[model samples]
Target: MFVLSSPSGTGKTTIARRLLAEDADIALSVSVTTRPMRPGEVEGRDYFFTDRAKFEAMVEAGEFLEWAEVFGNLYGTPKSYIKAGLKEGRDFLFDVDWQGTQQLHQRMETDVVRVFLLPPSIAELDRRLRGRGTDSAEVIAGRMARAQAEISHWDSYDYVAINDDMEQCFTRVKTILAAERLRRARQTGLVDFTRELMR
Candidate 1:
């Protein structure tokens, strides 16, 4: 599993979307949430929307690989079919917050690769949020207030991509993913290949 985390305006989601489109080997881990579905979002593809009661029941049943409450909404990675996919050599990409990343790493330390994205500057972050024109000023201020705390965990991630330039950052993340796939532990089938060659 690979994770990309960043403050709200840092463009991590965009990077993850492009990465998923370009890479055939990796699939995004769609999360389940209690938040209302937005206009363009499709069920299961974007998020598995559920009522608060059902979301809470899932937590009680321990159905989540990782879960967290963010800005009053509960979001979780369901432990659905991921184990079988992993055994078949599939990669999963997670676009999550730092809290979610922490929970995931705690549960799957060896299987996890964590990456954090940094906005170039506070001013730039503010600019990006304002430029989106999607959120109200109050909401933007709330996100800005929380950004610093979220970014404080940067040291915990294995890699950090500075979002100074979109293309450069995407290249760096893709390169990281490539290198991670080649790691000795992840290439378990290589043992059999090597032994066969020796025979």
Candidate 2:
């Protein structure tokens, strides 16, 4: 489980997009959400959109690996989907908030690799949010408030990246992934490979 978390305006989402586009080895874990889909977001690609009631039903059925209510919307990672992918030796990139990442790490600490992304500064975060020209002032205020709260959880992550420049930030993230992939326990066939080499 590779988690990338940041405040809304930080380059986390954009960096995540670039990772998915460039790295064939890493696949995005499409989460299920009750939030209304954005303008260009696809039904299944961006999120598996559903209603509150249905989402609640999924929760009741214990379908999620981690779930959280964010700004009145619900988001969850389906447990079965991710487990199957892991069994097949696949890597999944999770673009989730701090809360969801915490829940996942608590449940499977050994499997989780948490990365926290930060903006250059609060002022820059605010500016980037405004640059979108999408949200109203009131909405932006709420977002900025939420961003501060999210930043407070930054220390909880295993790796922290300050996203001042997009490409540089992505390179650092990719390096982290490469290092994690070589970890002894994460390399599933390493034991056999080592034993064969010794023989």
Candidate 3:
């Protein structure tokens, strides 16, 4: 399992997509949320959209691996989907926050590779947020404030990548994934295969 967490505009989703495109075994873990569908977001594809009451009910039922309220909406990863991915030996990519990462580590018998991405600088972050042209200046200011809080949790992650150069950052993330996949715990099947080859 891989937990890829970052502030709103740090390109975590882009890295996740690139990873899936490169690895045949990796599967992006689609999360369920109570947030309104953004334009072009499709049901059951981008996210499983639901109402706040229903989302709270899932929480009470212990159905989610982790849940967090963000920007007046709730987002969570369903526990069942993760279990199914593990059964299939699939690498699941979680584009969640640090809170979700902690929950997953406690509840699952999974090897989690956590990578937290940081913007090149506060100035660059501001530029990128404004570049979206979707949010007003007031909203952009709020996001910058929130981003500081988010990045403060950098120490909680296993690896940190500064996305100054997109291509370089992508390469670093890919390298991290390749190295993590070779961990002894993740390569149980490979151990036997290698032993047979040695014989």
TM-score of each: 0.89, 0.88, 0.84
| Ranking according to lDDT, highest score first | 2, 1, 3
Candidate 1 wrongly placed segments (more than 4 Å): 38-40, 132-141
Tens-digit lDDT string for candidate 3 (1-199): 8888888788887888888898888887888899899999998778899999999999999999888988798999898987887877788888877778888877873577888999999888888778658888898898888888888889988899999988899999988888988887887698789999999
Q: List where candidate 2 sits over 4 angstroms from the true fold.
A: 35-44, 49-51, 132-139
Could you tell me which residue pairs clash in candidate 1? none
Model 3 poorest 10 in a row by lDDT: 104-113
Preferred candidate (TM-score higher): 1 or 2: 1
Query: Residue 34 deviation, candidate 2, in Å?
Result: 3.8
Better TM-score candidate (1, 3): 1
lDDT of 1: 0.91
Local accuracy by lDDT, each model:
0.91, 0.91, 0.86
